[model samples]
Target: MEHYLPSFHLKGKLAAVTGATRGIGKAIASAFAEAGADVLLISRTDSDLKEMKEELQQYGTNIYTVSGDVQHYDEIIEKIEQKKIESSIDIWVNNAGINIRSAAEDVTEEEWEQIISTNMKGAFFLTQYAARQMKEKGYGKIINISSVAGHVALRTGVVYAMTKAALIQMTKTLALEWGNHGIRINAIGPWYFPTTLTEKLLQDEEYVKDIVSRTPLRRIGKLPELAGTAVFLASEASDYITGQTIFVDGGMTIYGF
Candidate 1:
């Protein structure tokens, strides 16, 4: 029997992840580092970046940090350009997002704008910049972190679902346009992952039970489970796959009630 698992290794590759200060983003960054990829971590907080960089050093892969607000298109473009001068990006993860859970009738204009600008607008511009560079090289992977809410109407905010659904479409459109250029665009939709955003929900016994009951796995997702999906999408193992949203939801989306 011959072993052929080396294709999954990200050795010698340069990967970039936005929202990498904590939660799913941080997990993905660390997974890439452990797989031998030099990771560029982006976040709005300087302190978080410093802390993450220190924690990631154990993986032995070169780690770099960029502090910027992704909501500003110009800032993201500038940072992408600067990073490009250093190394060609092989994998780009658009993981920066925000959600304000409120009923549609209760959603304020300000809340709507903030969610759309950060989740959709920011990801779009960043993808444009990354895709341009990838087009030049004829090889790249772009991963957008979507959510299960996008697939079905969850009790979560409608604006969040809208943004994520848009992301799924964006992945498909870009993949079709750039497949000839050796670029593969894809998305990951996570459900009920333990993160700062869901800290409150996780603490509520009723909400937790409701979530687990719906999920076939009967439990909330682990952050590392999300990381494994990301690693698969970022590496050569998924070279033939593109434009698909892989839901890491523990069967929540598949279960019907």
Candidate 2:
């Protein structure tokens, strides 16, 4: 057989991304659009969703925004269904997650519940709905935005770590269960990346130095790098890969300082 490069384009594909107005989620959403996929952005804030839609539309791909929360996947799915856009989804990103930093001793039941509900529970349920749609289509891609904290021990709040760890396991289990259906599920485990949420921490010289010292790359991750990883997983280039977590951590997971 003649050799040919595998495709990385997402042209004519329909994708959905949760918590997609900022940070890692936004980067993936924008990348999907740039790769020629029509995107449906999911978020709790209507204003943010609207703003992102406008930004993504410039890519010349269809940009749809659904104002909803992952905590209620059924309702959010219903909202998308009403718009008659749910069935056509080809890529679904479970990126709606949250973290609460608190000492283990000071962790509250409310905080634990909130983090668990949003990160693990919501993602699982959303994956269920997205998988259902993909099952009907006979093939699809699901990318979970996990974290380096999931695979290693860190000072990241225990509850947040718990949720991220669960996501890694969830990715494996779901891939095993769904692979026969032509759906591939994988995750991206990212380390420190400059985002609105971590703007202050990244600006602190001491913290930056500490982070750089620990990472083999000696630098923070760029948003496009993470986005590019997402694009690969979302495209046919990654069709044969599943149940895997690719760390976009700048080697932070390897160095223990």
Candidate 3:
């Protein structure tokens, strides 16, 4: 094996991915399984989790499911502790999040609270819990699923952007605080992926056209394309990397036009 090539292999490792039912989260879970990690899938729907476990079983990785709402931090922590049993949670992916697209002034208080609670508060606490476990074992990987909206004003939604930007900062801060303890923290900022969250927006021809024209790659992101970055972050290949937000957008962040 070369210097870092073998670091990409995740054989015998254990990973837990939140929001593992569909879209980016599911794709990331599948990727980790493909990389030979036993995965714990966490989602809100138990039925969906069951189906996902069936689908991911073929990857030859042990699949476990924990169902709960991420917004309910205590409930999620309890479920995770119960399901985790004696396994060391080596990798934790905070992929559970919500977005409410509204103008800054038009955004309701209720919507603001929902977005903040799930996107920011829930993920932060879960990361805290995961870090404590990781600290005990002396090593872990934490990957937070942020958004490109955090980097620049994409006009998606003001509050959504706020939460994501906070995630990026959180990644950096956690990495700084935990680096000596062997816990690595990083973030992924995706742009214009065709997930359930973007189903309605993808239907508008004008919106599609705008996305293509603005993106240097001129194509919306594919679900699988977003998985490799996550796999890399979760694996030992990223041992030297932390506190960085890798934007998985197709040149959207770098484009000047």
TM-score attained by model 1: 0.96
- Tens digit of lDDT per residue, candidate 1, span 34-68? 99999989999999999999999998988988889
Instruction: Give residue 8's error in model 3 in angstroms.
Output: 1.3
- The number of clashing residue pairs in model 3 is 0
What are the TM-scores, per candidate, against the unseen true structure?
Answer: 0.96, 0.97, 0.97
- Residue-level error in angstroms, candidate 3, position 171: 0.4
Would you list the clashing residue pairs of candidate 2? none
Computed on alpha carbons, the lDDT of every model, listed in order, comes to 0.92, 0.91, 0.92
Higher-lDDT candidate of 1 and 2: 1
Candidate 2 per-residue C-alpha lDDT over 35-67 given as tens digits, one digit per residue, 9 for 90 to 100:
999999999999999889989888998898888
**Candidate 1 wrongly placed segments (more than 4 Å):** 1-6, 83-85
CA deviation > 4 Å runs, candidate 2: none
Tell me how far the alpha carbon of residue 48 in candidate 2 is from the true structure, in angstroms, after superposition: 1.4
Tell how far residue 233 is off in model 1, in angstroms.
Answer: 0.3
